[model samples]
Target: MLGRQQDEHVRLDHAVIGGNDLSEIDDAFDSLGMEPTYAGKLENDINHLSQLGFEDGSYFELTATLEPGQESPWWDVHMQKDAGPTAWAVEVTNIASVVDEIAERGTPVDGPNEFGRERPDGTYFEYELATLGTKEFGTQLPFLIEDHTPRSNRVSTPTPSVADTELVGVGAVVVGLGDLDDGIEVYRQAFDLPEPSRQTDEEFGAELAHFPDTPIVLATPLAAGNWLADRLETFDDGPCAYLLRSSDWDRTTERFSLTGESSWFDDRLAWIDSERLDEINVNLGVLSP
Candidate 1:
């Protein structure tokens, strides 16, 4: 399952990177000119995820667990084993239906559970998710988001800093795993993503996956060898890739310098200045402290 894709597939709806290095993450933000919108917390049975706000509803989550006392899905495993991509959450219209569809194929799933961000009014925006698929699919299965909440009224408003804040979000995510080709096939049959081009490197391994639209791209290494490889090997086949955005690298990088530790990277993708990005627009919302 670690080779070129045979069919075409669509883009990823989003991507999530999980790591335990919060301080390093903060330091990475300092390198950027702006600051990260410190999203509070998302508590589940297994992981503790923190959201960072951006101009649009789009944001990247920082995840880890309190402790590995129990069998957990995210942080505990990541800390004990190794860091790697561990879930390919699909965007779906109906969580239950999607779960049923994948489960019929014998994939294990978790929620039509209500998940989302809390709006200023104290109302929460939510979406349903499916379970991770079976061992053959590498368990990259995750719930799809039918409703995506905009971070502000000016979600589309351009930022003065860039003068042209063109790039919206993660363009591609490169993942390193065991059965790259098999996972690619699962994405194709499930999401209808375009077939992908192939290549390989000794250190990185084989890659077979498609680039989703603006916002999220997914790539998987053919062989699971390094630290990243081990995570994919354990997390049951999810995200272990880096993100791509249609942004001016230099200007964005400069923001990293301006902001400080509010931003960070997981050796992949920039946690762009979300607070700064939203600052460009005239309208702002004040939620409770």
Candidate 2:
């Protein structure tokens, strides 16, 4: 429901997480039982984005800011935080064309500029990007267009074996917003979605909504400056949760050593990633929308 794309209009391309080091994050997930598949890397005059492939063809890109003297559009402004889920990448027929259509709707976007590297086989590689607006929580996902066709030899799909900690797909995303109702309305209107339902326990004012099957849940912090509220407060809102799933929960948890670090756990509701990303547990909470 989020992007206004029909089932065939755009393909779920990549779920990107912005961080300082791609290999470190990959290694952490690998140690967590995920058989990480190496995608390619990109380096311009400024930043870099590295992708990790899943068996199902979808992948996650880890983006990072280049050191001083070099600047990237995303890093200088959006990535000021130590690290976070910066954007999601979706691919359509043409990145620029989709940008035009999305822009017509008045969605804030960035260039779908050409970028690439020289390959070992004497071939050149390139791709384009058109960033969709960031969520009210500052989560920015883009529509990526690879330069090559699906049949090209560059695109390889590995038969992935179920890792102990394999994230099947994004289950639910919990966001923190300043104006809860307005934030929900923003997503609802953007994706042509419906109103959300309320589910609160002793702790939070949880309002959950869905997009077809994708669930987007929202929660109000117990205190104004709570951890979730503090860092993400500036964006008018920001991502508070990462709902991840796996083939084997025990194996996945074991691989990541989550049990050692997680402050909380619910066999079904939420679980923490042991290798902490910042102070947050890299929470795997909720389920598909």
Best by lDDT: 2
Residue-level lDDT of model 1, residues 1-289, one tens digit each, is 1111111122244445444543334333333421333334444545554333333334444445444344455445543442423333334445566667655655455555665755334656555544454542222544355554542421222232223453334344454445666766765555545665454433333444443232222445544465446545566555555343433555445434222211111112233334532222111111100
How would you encode candidate 2's per-residue C-alpha lDDT over 1-289 as one tens digit per residue? 3221234334455555655555555565555445454544445545655444544455555555555334556544444444455545455666666667666766676777766664334446557655556642236333446565331333333325342235555544556566666666666544445666554433433344334433355655555666556645553454555655454565555444342222112224434545445432244442211
| Top-TM-score structure, candidate number | 2
Badly placed stretches (over 4 Å) of model 1 are 1-13, 21-24, 43-48, 53-57, 66-75, 79-88, 96-110, 115-123, 135-139, 148-167, 201-204, 211-236, 249-289
